[model samples]
Target: MTSRPTPRRAVLTAALAVAAAASPFASATPAFAGASGSGPGPAEGAVDHRAWATFPQWSAGRGAGTRVIGGTRPGLVIGDPIGTHEYRDPHTGTTAAWEYATWLSPVRTLPAPATEVVVSFNARTPAGTWLQTELRGTYTDRTRTPWYVMGRWTSGDAAGDIRRTSVDGQGDGKSSVSTDTLAVDNPASGLRLASYELRLTLYRRPGTRLTPTVWRLGAMASDIPDRFTVPASRPGEGAGHRLRVPRYSQEIHKGQYPEYDNGGEAWCSPTSSQMVIEYWGHRPSREDLAWVDPAYADPQVCHAARHTYDNQYKGCGNWPFNAAYAATYPDLQAVVTRLRSLNDAERLVRAGIPLITSQSFLASELEGAGYGTAGHLMCVVGFTESGDVVANDPASPSNAAVERVYRRRQFENIWLRTKRHNAQGEVRNGSGGICYLYFPLRPTTRQARALASVGVR
Candidate 1:
């Protein structure tokens, strides 16, 4: 029997209310050092910047330890450096450590009709030491005479591995953590908040030698209502965006070309492009896989062009990879400018397109069962009222079974890596101007058949 799609609108509504009730006033403001103004939100097709606040500056600790803020410190740094640590256990002979970092910002009035506030981050084990982290948020009501712990969320990781943690809890403390999912709908106080704080403390077990290094932190604002009900229709239904499946029949197995398998060439973009061509029947004139490599790939060589393409992908492609790819593009300034244009979620909604993509091999072990290490792609067909995204992942083996529903924040972080910023500063592979492709929902029967022939339905 086929599994039924979850009623997202109802689920999101219920989840939001539950979250609000559970964790009443967990605080979140903005990032440190970054001022909160009406700047654009995250770039289009990229993760939205949920809140604005100050960075949790590492205050002086008791013992002698180095404190670094806004930048990297060499070694033995105290407090939170990217939210992880390595410390000597004074009590036991074993080396002890913790991963703790906080993002604090001042609260302006809450967004209109917003029933709750949420916080999210990414935690990973650098050296595979048994590690666990907790997500804590604090909120202080400025109006109240004496500040109180308005709300808090305490939950463990969803999957039991050490790769990373994504925590989502409501004001009432209904939360879960997982490796490749975005945790959202955490409830903060309904009262106007003066300040918000996020903290993570990581420490080694009773007997372990591994130190922790934090990779990413992703947080956002959400509109989880106070009551459970179906969500209103989206702003531009049937008017702007539509889904379209393609048509093609080509037998292209994974290992058909030894050069692709042996890494003789960078196959990520081309392979994806080929999938698009085969699935959609739109082949580019330039058959040579290396056609655009010289002008677009190789960050060291094609810097400016790469940035332009990256920016174009985000601003025009309306896909997350567009913004993500800017991270690797040669020209940093171009990337910044492109990213700046997409500053808010409203703009993305206006675009009438939802960016969708996927990652592979990173969390294969945790992806239930039967799914393979080969990564895949799909579009977010729509959002359910319950704060879940309706996704169309074409590569999954089952047809008609292509549609999936996921928690909004969890899906965003897992698919887009919103929490983990790229340190190497490389363009994301799926961004436009490379291998990524976009299609509307309305398609001819032939196109649909072709898509079905492959794994995309």
Candidate 2:
């Protein structure tokens, strides 16, 4: 029910490329391999998701003024500022000089030729700092494209921070980036992304000791053929199990915070995010909710809406932004990724992880939903003994009504299918199994195995 105006911006060509230090500074972090490959290789399957998340992977990558931090969670941090450059925050029309450093990931050749790529990140950006994610890729024909800015993000909404958002107009004719996704302009032209590299630039106000630590950086490359339906997989593992996840309904917040996407249904994305975030024992403190009206119950839901609202998209539903918001809490890590099947989702639930999933459907398509949505987010906490989806749906009239059970066949098709018809019978796009996964900096042994099983370690 939430829509936004096209984000218009003056061409922001902030190319203050400060070269990384050219010397090798040695360290003793146990660099691990890439999020051990899954889905399939370059010539098979419809999806290939790869990420550089461990110390060894970050170590394998070339970094300038960056250091590898090893602990329960191995990550990259800015050790030194390579140079200083002035950046103009496009949204605020403000400019400032900032010290920066960078880490470049090794090129990853996809297992399948992909028509689309979506990048997700996990990091904690302090008040005065932020990070930018970019990609440069080779086509199936070996021709290369320029580095496209996927997102320039900060967890803060303060005056000193740059407005966090995905660049609006990044493309090279053959492809274009829409929000968080990079799409091939003409998939029929027989061109696809074969390999790509990720560049992470860390920035902090000049001469400050503050730095950003990135725990995970990755992309989901997909080439799914357009189909209204997908074959259902046999249910296993997660049936008969459920996690005790808290619930909050977006409908109850109607007209409460219009400045943040007019609240109400527009708050579904962040409402669901907050549920999972709290399930893991984290929440906004009283000080964090101080700005909210004292009469408003569950003030943190309002807090989430404000912090996650993208100045560019003018909405709080930006996928990566929600994931980034979860990572803002200490010791939490989150990523926006695509799961191939319900079986895959079961793996995470088995490991005690609740997923925030995205989908678009008509009221008649998903039984018991009572209403339809062009786009919506809900927490998939578990599966019923009969294999139905047990979800903490935030579309209810109250928190007491938030927990719902959706049919397995109906939920599967709605979540996985990339195409669907509206109530009026017009064709519209679906979310294609997009999900937000959040866990601790150090997960349980079972959680670790479950995460690694889904290629997320």
Candidate 3:
């Protein structure tokens, strides 16, 4: 394990305390084996993919394999960190097996009629290899669907974030990639997301070596019904003061960082990440970001994307991955969670922690955020005196144009609901409320209570 700075250790201790109090699953052990709900179903994968155990009996491959090590962060360690050995049929020489390892999480029950499921991991792998994450679910009647390939992610230049594909039901790395995020959408078929499990597979090319490690894994299921609605809420506690968060615009890097997903136009996540990190007084050093162009302003934004990239997912906006990257710095703590409402956001800001949120809204729906996006990320720094939202929107044409105040009701509609376009151009079902909390240290007791009440741990 890498040694943490003294200040970081203090933060970790406090974070642990907070988690112990706030999270019911904090110290619970993951069952590791997937579960199948009642009903007649097909047999599941036989290989035991439990983390930290000896490798399972596969179609091929040899050696002792790896072990799952425990720490402030627990991860698997591959004994054979380098080298490529193809395990194939001796008779045909057709490559039957490539070097790989798998881990499956215990099954989780999803909200009924879930239209889409989002899975994320906090992982670090050597430069060449990629991590493939898959999700498979069982219906209430016990019918099992084939494994849905969520994404494949390699570190640095090869990361592919948010990959969706039509899977061939095979657990190998050859599944086709798609732009869709839905894993199981059978509203008419009578199949609802009952119980689902996750699998991680590692892949590497010949002549390359590096062990891959995963720190944390998470997934969430959303129904995203055809219509959208949000319940009424009481006033936020901190309805007046806005934090002085530094702004960075994704548009400024539009043409640059092409190695990433089309540069700044798709860089809302990284730009928002940069704003919060800078607000906490830690900037990546020149040597740290030496690979980026010296001519570009705020090169750290690009640096953030590179480090947060998932080779298989093919994008840089993985929620937990970005939060994990921020925690790399000293005295910083970050976690990805869904906030029930803006009152949850207000508590964090009141505690001096800025939030990075994800949403999809039309240009006309959100005032001051010029332009519509199928998806985007921005920082929620604070609230106006009358309970409006204060944000650093990186989608602006320039950095100076990034700060904006948005009306409370309108902002909530965009932030918390799922939506689709109707025939008359009306937006429906806008239900998405995902955010990451970035903080320098523990907040006051009252602030922590508020954060805890809103599920912000």
Candidate 4:
């Protein structure tokens, strides 16, 4: 094995996983995977997206002491205390008693076997309340995988932060969880997940009325081909269109919050998340920023770095963690999904939704980046008239330098491919066109159609 490690799957040994991203398909999902016609099941294609966000969807879940809410924005909530348990936060070693209730989603079988699965949601976890998401899968051999903890999270620090995080060292001999992704151990073995169910355990301080309301609960299961390069989409489809998103470079705050993911450049995930979040008119309150250094340039960026930091991953690049963090904002919902091509991204971008993409590339591979990264996250704001990619890359030295237009062919190759070569010319994995989408909980009709066209609800 040549010695260059994957920044995302393994960030610490050789280098950190700081990367960029690609686009996807948003075809209408069938009601369930393997179901005829489009229904609520798994999306049928190279990628499958299934979500529960409507009244009927919430009502379908088997809830124990959990209320199926009916309203303009439907969801599930803690109806009554099912039981109590004490949680010892691994990050802080703080133990506390919490009353919890559960909501189990209907099992979804993929139309095609999947090598990886990622779960995300949009929920409001008030102070004294948080949620735990877990996944249990059935393999092609009909054997089942253990329930893997996807995330333990809250939106803000109001409840002492609780240090929202993903668990590590969780896996069976067959499959495992890498940060926010639940994946098969060896796709080469043809051991893929056939079906899976998600569990949401809502927790709150005991002896209180606090409850967590989740409006969007979903997962993306995909079997992306492993390739060194992919066919790029035709250029200039939605050119000359770019949204005005806030720009904050990860390099600017280098060395400021070293405790978070070891500080500095490791913060690309949260930094990119914060930019899109503010573009939608949300920011941390003054009290929220009170802990950050006053002299810091953009306190919100620092705030995001701290809040989205994953103690187990020891970095801020956790995919679902960042999506969950974006959902913490008012009237917002976020999900992590894969896109087929930049054309799909253009559809969403035209609909006023910016995306945070993960990618790895050599400096020589992607023009004008001026640097190579193992893994990095950046915001794709728009496309130029020439069909070039206009992104608010946080890797810049200053905020003003954050916006960049890159060649479509080169950008797509790096962000979309599954296999790549490091500086040492050793082959490694790419992000496989993974991206984070943040949008309104109640979207406009145009936005809804755009999201649906890209296979999101």
Candidate 5:
């Protein structure tokens, strides 16, 4: 789901109102300080910031007690995984600490002032065990803020599919499934050298013998330049500019499958995800999508919606959730990252991968598309000979009406401009220039080189 800023908020309100309202980050201030050696260099239109801390590189926590199981072993989780222990307090009859483990990442710096930062990884643990992923950053002043909880998820079938149930401190205890990863947003204004510490904590009941395991962890940050302008000349760019991508429309499925957020009308995210998933030649089996409407031709989209829905957020368009859901598929390397521009996106299209992009625009802001949306998700299938955007927009009335083109400049503004009104009516940038790339870990010969050139798996 592209982050349609306005209508989606309205959707959230309307849905919550019907249910009499469903339910729904960073610490402290440090003196500003400069980064060491200027940190990383930036790209022209956008900066791609990435820092990874796989288990092998992580050291057990100190000062506070830390726990580790088979450290960095294949098929083994190497983080804290202790069962709960209960004790009675003077005032309270009984008390318990479900949280029992902690793992920390080596401090690093974010290359840019990012609009979004997401931590992703794979893990396995028995049912009932809960895990919390949090991140804290050191400022230029050399002081660190307290940890910010990104998400809480329980372990699920590592090989079967990514089923992650995200829970809040106060949740219904319904487990969620993800594609082996979870993410949270850091809305800190202005970019700081935030590639600092990423903490992973594990929790479980006192009697539960099974412990949560974490196999891998990674963090990515994305930001775009204040403004981007297409170079005056590009000799061969946009020259064979059309990608062969299948189309799906969200409107067609509207109200069809109410179980998954009213089906199609609210399904642009999963519908768009399905198009890319199928483009990679992978589709869910009938049994996998059996929960969907039998009358629907593409039940896989419905399956995606069910899997990507965040119980706490109460929406299917959570950016990291969508990317994590795509990664659940076999042999796919997917991530919730941002692209610098159409130029960078075209690189993916040329590599045989289409991007699921988020944007918001007025109906009149973008031409060809019949309506405007506060936030929306669409596919960047290819470019026109003139360097325009050709998108597989699921917002259309039907699958046949899904494809459309827009001037490159106009589309860029809609896609790159991230400022929007919050629930309080103040404007702020949410996730900026966010896009997900779902591609095979290994590509065919024709696309192998292209994928390599763009740093895609």
Candidate 6:
């Protein structure tokens, strides 16, 4: 086994205390009450509408569909005619749009002593549009009056490729809006359940009607996780020496893979997953790599179509599809069934698992899609107490190694889209229908040996 540094004992001790305090109780009084869009003053406590809504699920390499991870809440529809057709791109005929708006009903109760409320969603804007997608939150108090305009996150401009905008005033050279996290907590309002709506709006020239291709919706809590500090290491210190992994191009060439000139193949999931293993000084047991290779070969295993009608592949390595696939497949029906049964966030926290992904941008996706650009991989490492997901995206030029926090709803919309589950209840490649290998966080010698017997090193 590799000798990785363990988290400080104090940090783990404090986290346990926080977890104990947040345990759910059957007798706990509901937080928010009344109906959605009631009045503006605080209602009862805070009922997270997102948790109760139904979300869509897209088959690996297929188009989008609706489903939720934990509950049976149905997903909302955006654009015209709900849940009928996906928003499509005008120039390329590809689909693009944020998922639908999912909010809690007014009659539902909120978590007890609700002090905060938040809503999040995953968005993928159309290419070449000035604006990618629009997300809005409407917080109503007991009176059904609009209490606050929470904030908005915008992607794109009048014309250009798609980009992600942060609501916290942090973005990658894209126009953005801001929201205050602390303002949502108001004891006096006596708010109960919070209702929210996320719309996938498109933008065109001043008088032109904008069109979008896809849209997704969901919600998460606004409470921040207790902060735990890691032992400080100087820049380029600790495991830095082992972090050097081959670039995507090099990996492809060295592995003797096909040249993706026709934009039909997807390397995003596999490439990114591989980077996480390599950078962390971990290698995929022979079994893990075996599952991954076949998964990448077959495009139909995922939500976004891997190949064009011309037989050219547009695999996960490149744009709109890269973003689209990440958004849709991660939360597919099969995978959600497994995730909903477990407390994922809590389990990861306990296991010290470092989550990661393939975060390709328009430029990278375009280049990779066009068979001209190399791919990039990223990691999602942290979350706030209230469940805001954070990523350690390596694609950003300035903060490549830094953490970027996103609302959990937004993060999950994308993350869930990429998750793959086979018939046997295991993670696999959606396109090729191959089972990917999984390694327990702490493997016993017998388990390791059993894995090796199946050709996993």
TM-score top scorer: 4
Question: What is the descending TM-score order?
Answer: 4, 2, 5, 3, 1, 6
Best by lDDT: 4
Error of 1 at 322 (Å): 19
Candidate 5 regions off by >4 Å? 1-46, 51-80, 85-102, 112-116, 122-130, 154-191, 202-216, 223-238, 256-259, 420-431, 443-457
Error of 5 at 92 (Å): 24
C-alpha RMSD of candidate 4: 5.3
Worst 10 residues of 1 by lDDT: 332-341
lDDT of 4 by residue, 1-457 (tens): 0112234453111211222121122232332221123333222236788899898998888999899888777888999989998899887788988999999999988877777899988888888899999999999999999999999888765655477788888889888887788877766555678899999999988899989899889999887755677876886446778999999988877778667854457788889999999999999999888888788889899888877777777777778878878887878889898877787788788889999998888888889998888888899999999899999999888999999999999999888887777888776778778899999877888788777866687
Listed in order, each prediction's TM-score against the native is 0.33, 0.89, 0.69, 0.89, 0.70, 0.32
Q: Across residues 178-209, which tens digit of lDDT does each residue of candidate 6 receive?
A: 23121232222333223333333333322223
lDDT of 2 by residue, 279-387 (tens): 9899999898889999888899999998788877778987888988898787898888777678778878988999999888888888899988888899999999988
lDDT winner, 2 or 4: 4
Candidate 3 lDDT, 1-457, residue by residue in tens: 0110111001112222223223222122221122222211111101111111112212122224444666455555454433344533222244522456566666766434343455655566665555667778676567776777665554454332222222232322211123224333323333445667877666554434556666555565543222254554555776896899999988877777555665666678778998999999998987888888888888899898777654334566666567767766655656665555687688778877788887766678787776776667889988988999989988887889888888888888677754444335643333256677776544578656655554333
**Root mean square deviation (Cα) for candidate 1:** 17.1
TM-score of 2: 0.89
Residue 148, candidate 5: how far off, in angstroms? 1.4
Overall local distance difference test of candidate 6: 0.29
Model 1 misplacement above 4 A: 1-114, 122-124, 128-195, 205-210, 224-354, 357-457
Q: How far is candidate 2 from the true structure (C-alpha RMSD, Å)?
A: 8.5
1 versus 3: better TM-score goes to = 3
Q: List the candidates ranked by lDDT, beginning with the highest.
A: 4, 2, 3, 5, 6, 1
* Candidate 6 or 1, higher lDDT: 6
Cα lDDT of all candidates, in order?
0.28, 0.79, 0.57, 0.80, 0.55, 0.29
Shift of residue 184 alpha carbon in model 2, Å? 1.3
